[model samples]
Target chain A: MTRSVFFVSDSTAMTSKGLGRSLLSQFNVTLSEHLRPYINTEERVDILLNDIHKTHIEDGDAPIVFASMMDEKLMNKLSQGFAGVIDIFRPFMPTLERLMDKKSSKEVGQAHKVGNQHLYQKRVAAIEYTLATDDGLKTTDYDQADIILLGVSRTGKTPTALYLALNFGLKVANYPFTSEDLPEFTLIKAHLENRHKLVGLIISPERLLSIRRERRALGSYADPKAIAAELAALNSLFARESIPFIDTTTRSVEEIAASIMAISPT
Target chain B: MTRSVFFVSDSTAMTSKGLGRSLLSQFNVTLSEHLRPYINTEERVDILLNDIHKTHIEDGDAPIVFASMMDEKLMNKLSQGFAGVIDIFRPFMPTLERLMDKKSSKEVGQAHKVGNQHLYQKRVAAIEYTLATDDGLKTTDYDQADIILLGVSRTGKTPTALYLALNFGLKVANYPFTSEDLPEFTLIKAHLENRHKLVGLIISPERLLSIRRERRALGSYADPKAIAAELAALNSLFARESIPFIDTTTRSVEEIAASIMAISPT
Candidate 1:
């Protein structure tokens, strides 16, 4: 008899993304999808009760319910019927209550002001850099990239670009460094030439070996010696082309993005 | 004369990009190159003191040192030196201190385990989806994207795509739906027939009028009827192709992304 768990909340809570999915993975139970966004208090309560009734009559397992930012009236009502439910918001209530109590304090107001100001300033700064260009760089377009990433295979480039774009708000463009374009330097054509920065990424031979090995399980591409040769060739080309490259062997995407953001000329 | 404000702290402080930048904008103070990860006590003191000295001696204004998450030892040392500085961490101190005092509580350990399990489950679910794809979907290469974006036109596609990518971790390739792209998309074949999704966002006529007026003060593109017609044509084509589309007139990127993610059939 598998115990079923029901997550009834707004749309954000129901999606297999964000906090809802995170919380659901904890318990060994099935999740009911009856809860959805923009649900009125009455509908939510009905869904909760229905779920409880279904679980009690059919499964005979008292299902656990996790709700986010739920209405107080509805929660109180559900608590009466579903005694097995867990309200996650209860944990954060202390923090929220403390914040509310401190709302009267001058220091709390000042800190909030400072925090809001920081948010605005960052957006403005991001906007300013996003408008620059390369070459004559007269217009705000592709020519203004601080660093353009080009790579082949499973070189973690996109997440790195996004990290640059979101964290630093840098204008980053990436093109695939395919085998046909073996020597990647000369391909830096038109707007990309000498205007924007370029960074090449090289993965370690052994690391590439294992990644490919896991892919096809003992395929020719997974051969360590072949992977090593490919990496060495890529490295040679990078050195010859005078492109600053980093080996993303053991670093998390955050670490790699941070390093790139650090070296990037601001 | 501009007042200099030094924001010194570790990753959490430096990484508070949006919040920090907004605060600095309100003060009319320029942030010096002191922000970095892993700053120690002496470094903090040196930065604060130097900035204070520079503001007093050179700029003839008091320096506002907005420090976040400074070590307690360093905070004490600096507070003694610069009486005028504001310690943002002070607001969070009481709560943090309380938590520290309760470090021995069984509740803390249980809460941590629950949170970790929640995160592990979410990542596991995301990875499960990632592993099933073959077009280098599981791999983190940003360049092989189906659609590359380029537009200064405030087409609002980048933020929209970023919303989809970051939130859903979808391989959403977004090229700016610009005047340039008006010709480009016409020429290139839609590679993502069933494999990927393409979304074109058109802003409302009124919004386009106001946005264009702000930038150029006047333009044919800014004409309400002209803008309306263009959007109508784009909307018609999108509808005809059965391509999913969004009117980013009244929605945040988050909202647009949510809609896209909902319809993405992922």
Candidate 2:
């Protein structure tokens, strides 16, 4: 039987899910996660308390809770009943409060709203910009881009760009390196003006061959020689243009985005 | 004059950043944040130690580090020199270890790679599917979609859809309800088969007006009366069709997505 796990939170940012994911990964347990978000009011808390009790009864095991409650009274109320609870945020709050020389607002969802609405807008706008500029579509607005990624087809330029935009609020425009810009070893003509922001993406020929073959197995698109030449040329161009590049061979999108942010500050 | 802060981790997942953002928000501090990712070795730890030391000297304050290093030896080594380090994951480890009756692998980054590469591929495919089906372009894949979003212009369908696809690896296809289908009270012609997966997104007319006005100042597109009628009709359609709906007026994309997942658990 799968253990029932509850991700309880006062704030509505899916905090418990993200916080619990890393912690829970350290364990080897088969769990069914229930998200109880916006757990602010006494009424909601009462419902959750009952839900947890029912879950305990039904599962025949005390349901584990990963909570990030901001309210002290509400947390106290829940703590009274739950035996297998881990207050995820409470462990860190005391040190933070002491360090800042201030008490937390204790108001639900206040921490995020302080200066984050602007950041929220930035992310939404970045998503739009990334989509509009995907695969080198809109170069005229390259001036407004935070970073530009250059790569050959299917080297994972689009997904990486969207990840940066969605998670980091960075406007990223990605261009697939074309064979036309070849021989001269230039990446792109007009949009290379954002050259300061340009970063190249590279993948192993073997990996690209397999990925391409997955879509269509008939063409030179999956040819080993063609893929190898394309990569070698791209590497030469990256070196000649003094552009920083990443090998997206084994890295996940999140890892790639993090590496890009570290490699290029913007 | 800003305090220096570092998000230290053996993870390449930006664990430190995500963990640090939620925790640091509880305090009142002006800080410059540094991401020290993929800190898997003693050599890397030595470099980080040196960087932290230099930062302390330059800032005239011991740089605060929010660490999630799984390796106990590396954590001990870093703790020996740093005064302002918070071991974010240490407190919960004992309880988890006891509960699971298993020792954590402590092999850096192994937790995520377990069955998550398939999840990563799911996300990439979801992103592609969401893009292809966005704004009702490709309806043949309705059978393959996890959820279908119905909304008018600029109600935050595409962003929410993309967020679900990227973060949760859920394939979401969204279609804008056209005024042509108004008299019949049907949402879309061909996609009605996926009505069980349909979720209508609503927004305040005033909010929609302001948003639309930002794009173009003139036309019925931004008209308040027009927007009001559209929303009223959509709500009626939601009631008549018995499809679930969400109000995106005040919610951030994260909040909206969280609410949608709660409202309609696809």
Candidate 3:
């Protein structure tokens, strides 16, 4: 059976959608998803309520509403009319009030707004640094890097670097170990100079072969034999240098980044 | 007085922290923030509760708790002890039940578990495309891009492009306008070829001047006169070519990206 799910929020609806999707995925059911973002107005909420009621009647079931509305009056109105209204914000406000001994301001759309100029500038700078130092393109600024990620080609280094930069406001630089730099004991000059910031990433040969094949079909880069050899050499190199490495075979970029952060100084 | 706020979650605590920070920022108060992630155990909840009680006695105010726990027993235990417990998830579950006419799975940490392989691969491929075509580096692949952002130096083009790629899985390429390309009304070869995918970004001269000054202390790039001339010329060029442009002076990267998505065909 198909169930309708609506993610409603005063801002982007990203958080609502994320949490809703996660919870819904656990059930053995197909979902028809709808997103209603920037729903800060009473009129907008009314329109959404009408739509929800109509969906409920037409589908012969109540349409589930995942709402992150911060306004108390609007939320109360929604709860009164919709039986399936999931208030994402109100349940937390009373507890916060008792703790701080102050009532919440009940403001909306403040989470994703550019509130702090200093923090915003830092994030922008990190993004710029990530782009500039990507794939070891420019090594002159290695000293400024917060962390450096090294991995073989197509081993999930670039996405990890960008994730670190975006999420944590970190200046992350990533380098790839090409075939020419492999099968030897010595490290590259840049890696040697910035050994302290090095974090290695390695993937299983089977996974690496498939990823490489997607990028360049019918090439030795995707050969299982070559991939196995490279991974073995790289593993030894990481062990020799005492560099921490993670296998990205079954991990997401977030998992890989969190692991790197936990192990690395950055 | 300093108020303490704890963001407790059974998973990454990202949603709890995001919404909590946004709501708390509306009040003019000093807050000591803490995040307690992966609080899935009864033992862990006991420790958190003890910490909250101690903070309350020490500060003479109860500590604010923003929790997204999915476990009913743990949440009940928390509410019984913590006067300031904000239940982030449970309040919405009942409404969801009535709407879907089914009980929730009540699972945790599933929102960002790399569930869909196809979507994950698409996001990775988009990131690669964005890095490859950044700052007009590889115009040969412009035909494959979903969107192209154009602006003068430091008009918030790169961050917007990266945000589009990271958030929406869109292949975004950005180009900066230089003085050499100014004064004449003719479009560049690449712009002429992919005019349909183009989205122009314009910023206020004062803001542009300051941003450029931050990058280069004393150069023509940062000069107010140079910024004014470039912005005027770029505006006329966009008008002449009937290209859509957004003013990035007051908008956040998220706002700018949403506007671009609304207007762009992609």
Candidate 4:
């Protein structure tokens, strides 16, 4: 039987959905989800309850509700009628209140609003910078970059760069290694100048081959022998230059970015 | 006095930081933060508590803690410590248990792990697709895009496209409008063919002018009059073609993406 899951929150409901999906993935069951964000008022709550009650009667099974509502009255209203109610915010507040020796503001939807324009502008600027400097497109401003990523194609550089820009407000530039730059072990003049900001990304030959194969089918570029040679050359280059690097074969972009942030000079 | 805030979690601590920052921004106090992720073990908890205690003594004030640990033992240990502790997870678990009449697995860090290889690969593929089709590049494969964003420069199209790709596993392509493509009000052949997928983004003249000025300090491109004309022309085109549009002057990328998803056909 397919289960109905409702992600209810006074704000974005992102955390509710994320945690709900994580928990639900453990069980082998099909679930239909409804994302109900900005459900702050009693009117909205009444509508949500009606929808849930209707689904319950129609399916003869209560729906699961994952909520992040800070309002205790709404949480009480939701808890009484659902098959399962996971209020992500309320349970943790009391502990926080006791620990802080103060009360929470019991506010809603503050996580995503534009409270700090400076921080917001920084994120936007970083995004623009990332787009401008992507894949070695422009290097005139490489000196201004917070971190520069160097890697063979499809080694997860672009996504990692964008993630750093979006999450940490870092100005990230990335360059991909090509066949022309191979064998000579010569860095471009711009790269040489900004070598201190460089971090190399390498992946297993097998994984590289598979990823390239998906992009372009059955070419020399996707051949395992070619990939192995390129990786070996790149590794030697990184070692010769004493540049730090990470293997992206198994790690997620978050993990790789975190490692880079840890090692790279702020 | 600058308050010290610790974001502690058994996972990435992303939610802890996000929610913590949101709440903290409401208060105008100066605060410093430490993000302590993957805090799963008793030994780690001891270290964390000790650190908090030390900070309390040094600052002569308690450090606030925002936590998301699933382990009750860890929660108990943290609650006894200095300042306030916000356990983001536990308060809701009991309510969920009562409603569902089931016990939680009490697992940690499941939200971000590569639990499903298929979903993970889809996200990566979407990212690759977004990069390939960025800035009106490679329209030969426009049919493959799930959403096509059309806008003038600095209308927040590229970042919105990337956010959709990263967050929703959507293959997004963005095209920027130029003066050459304007006046005639003619849709590009590729855009015309895939009109159903197109979502227009427009920004206020003042905001667009400021954003463009940041890119090129004082050029014809950054002229306020030129930007205003471009926005008026684009809005007219959007109106003439009956394409839905969003004004991104005040909206964040998350909000824009959500609105697009709400209107766009999945």
Candidate 5:
């Protein structure tokens, strides 16, 4: 029987879901996954318990719950009714508490709470900064950017930049380099100055063709020969400039962002 | 003495960081947190151990490590050297293995790996769709949207929409509702047809003024009286039309997205 897995939590269930997905990737099993968020109230808890019980009874296998709930009462109740309860926080909280000689607040949804308004506001400002400088607009303010991405059109630049800005609170500015700009390949003043933060992104010509063609079914934009020439020029330009780059052809945005974050100067 | 906490992992260190931050938020301690990603190599692990040992000796307290490493050899070395090793994956792995009657893969960074190209491509497509429909552009294509966010200026719609699309793989289309459209707050045919997917977003006049003024130092757009009237009219429009709205005055993009995800019919 296929096990039904649940990522349940008092908050957005994101922490539970992120960690749970990672944990489950290790196992060889056929399972259905569901996210149960905002499980703070007893009423919500009761409803979730009903689902877990129903799934277990129907599937003939106890449903496994990966929970990040903070409330003691809620957790105990859940553990009592569900034999497959796996605490996602592990048992390290007590060790940490003892080591520090302090008690845990045990509050729910503390991770996502806007406790520090300054940091939160800075994140919002980073989003604004990334958006205003998107697609090479307003490059005069590139000095304020924490990172800058350079790539040709449809090379996964905008999503990667916005992901960095949204997730890591980094002001990312992405400039598009079209095929026309290749013959006289010269860096703009902003890019030349912020060369330390420059990241080049490239995609395989075949994949680029598919992606671009999806956007514009007609035109020389998705022409195969032109795409190959453009990528070759981009590769040479990156080598000449001694800039680090990532190939997005087979990588997820998370993987690309992680590589960039690991190599980011800041 | 302050604890030098490290979120160490073989992959992006995001899983370790996300869960570690939540676990640490429970405790009351002064933590100098560091994210150590891509520690998949023995040389990298050696370098990380050097930092941990140095912090332990200098601070007269062992550095706490929250590791999500999947390699059995690396985890063994780490646990042997450090007394404060906290495995973020916990003891559930063996249990899950037994439950599933299968051996674990023990692979690194599997969560972020593009194992399913369809899901990965869908996520990228969602990002593109969100950008193409950002700020009310291409409204005719709203029929294909998974969710549509309606808001006045400076109401956190664009960032929220992008966050939903990028993180959750939702085809989010956001349309701007300016003060000029207050009296004539009529839904276009596309939005009217997809009214079930519409989510109205609002911000307090005080916050709106501050945000708009940050973009433009002087303008009737940031005028206090105008901002108040705009919100009041928008509220009545939402009420009359029975459109559920989210107040984004103090919420983070994650928070707003969470609420929407929980309430979204789709």
Candidate 6:
């Protein structure tokens, strides 16, 4: 039986923006959300109770409740109220307090200060790179790029790009392909003639379907036939362009980024 | 023969501080301190002339010079003064201008305006994780970190950490081990036993010595024997603690980070 978890916070906690969703996908856990900024603790408790009232949680179902909040009294109340229904997990709060205390004792070095500069430059560069071209592949801003990434959506483009930009001072740009761009010839023509170095990301059809289904309701777009076709087309484009691609179907974004750097020009 | 080119920029041009040194290491490049803000064209030209004079490149040692500048007149003066000696490479200006122009036209997206709460929370959590204990593994500050990087130094930790914090909305922190910590296993033991997820970074002894030599001119501490001993100790610590580490002697900070994500706890 899979464990069901609810992540309740502002909009940020709802999305796997930085905390590696691809890595989490491997576990048999399902995460749902109820997030809003203005809702106070009492309001949140009410809403959560309402959600639980509606959810079909069986007698033996395991559910975890994760929250990021500023209210202590409300948290205590909710914790006491939902002790039986959920395993309340407040993950980031303790982390924040510890960081505040540490900063008070020591000053970061000049070298580390320089690292922060690189991090900022990379992010600015990534956003700039994406805005530069329509296909999201070409960039005359080559000198500015610490690193540039190219691939399809849900193949770990944004996170990897942000990781490089945010974590390694690499300016990264990524572009997604629409269904129209899936034809073998179109893929070849769009990405092949470019002089910029390209890295391809390929995912397993099953994983792609699962991700797509989660994005919307399960539909034709998330069907196996469409996924297989896209994967096959992606393979052909990678081959024709001589661009080395990774099968991200089972790998984490960190792995993909690592592989990209192993072969990057810089 | 490797090409020798000089990169000149002032404070603003020197994005993320110490990266200039890394770029210099990667390329046969000479970086000059001509990048100063608010200076007039005449002074800028004088600085360029001085850098050229100091190098004693008689109009043709290397035909290209990369300068990040805002003054067109200064660039023209530089071109005329040196003639065959330099061809200025101002990579950021054109892109910067284009981006500025495009920004006015962009329709802000819901995602952009929503402020990625999750990313912010995760960052806070990561910072808290680093600072929760007196373990010298990580350090953080909002002003200091942008992103705090937790790892042992010489693992490309300094550069990668800086790049992330400076280039993006991140704060980075890094720590290094001294010979005193080599024989003692207490630090590593306590770190692992406490469930602290330590990010270990390992580099080749030879490369560590070479890099240390560049930073500190031929000190006894940088000798091969000392470096080898320290690296061996680090390896043993990582192994015993079941810490995941990467060999980063040959890789750049970007590559190291990519690899870190690939292996880090999801």
Best by DockQ: 5
Q: How many backbone clashes does candidate 3 have?
A: 0
Poorest lDDT segment (10 consecutive residues) of candidate 2 chain B? B181-190
Please say which candidate is ahead in TM-score: 3 or 5.
Answer: 5
Task: In angstroms, give how far residue B237 of model 4 lies from its true place.
Answer: 3.9
* Recovered native contacts, candidate 5: 0.58
For B1-266, candidate 4 gives per-residue lDDT tens digits of: 47789988776677677667656644444677777776888898899999888888888878888887877788788877544787666555565565555676777655555344455578788988998998889998899999999998888787888888877789999998886665545588898899999999988888777777777877668987777778888989999999999878877676677778766886
lDDT of 4 at A69: 80
- Each candidate's lDDT (Cα)? 0.48, 0.79, 0.78, 0.77, 0.82, 0.46
CAPRI-style grade of the A/B interface in model 5:
medium
Q: Which candidate is the best by lDDT?
A: 5
lDDT, candidate 1, at A3: 46
Task: Report the poorest 10 consecutive residues by lDDT, candidate 1 chain B.
Answer: B103-112
Clashes of each: 15, 0, 0, 5, 0, 35
Candidate 5 residues B1-266, lDDT tens each? 36778898887788887887787777655567778888888788888888999988888877778897888788878888777888887566887776667787987777865345666667788988998999999998988999999988878888898899888789999988787786657678888899999999988888889888877867678899878878887888789899999888877788789889888886
**Tens digit per residue, CA lDDT, model 1, A1-266:** 25455554433332212233333333323444333333336765776588578877876555555554335666677767776555543443333234223222211112123333344234323433432331223333445566766555556665556545644556665555444444332444533364437677788777666666655666556767656556666677667677777667765444566556545565
Instruction: Write model 2 residue lDDT over A79-160, tens digit each, in one string.
Output: 8867777888778877867665568665566445534557677887899999999998988889999999999888889889
Candidate 3's docking class is acceptable
Tens-digit lDDT track of model 3 for B78-173: 889887777766656655565556786767656565345565688799998988888877988889899998888788787788777876789999
Tens-digit lDDT track for model 4 on A50-156? 99999888877778888878777888877775646776665555555565556767676555553444666788889889989998889898988999999888898
Name model 4 segments beyond 4 Å from true. Answer: A1-4, A22-33, A38-61, A69-83, A95-108, A178-196, A232-244, B22-31, B40-61, B69-83, B96-103, B106-108, B178-189, B217-225
Point out where model 3 deviates above 4 Å: A1-4, A28-35, A40-63, A70-85, A113-115, A184-196, A239-242, B1-10, B30-65, B69-85, B113-115, B184-196, B238-242, B262-265
lDDT of 2 at B159: 86
DockQ of each: 0.09, 0.47, 0.38, 0.32, 0.58, 0.02
Candidate ordering by TM-score (highest first): 5, 2, 3, 4, 1, 6
lDDT of 5: 0.82
Q: Which scores higher on DockQ, 2 or 6?
A: 2
Best by TM-score: 5
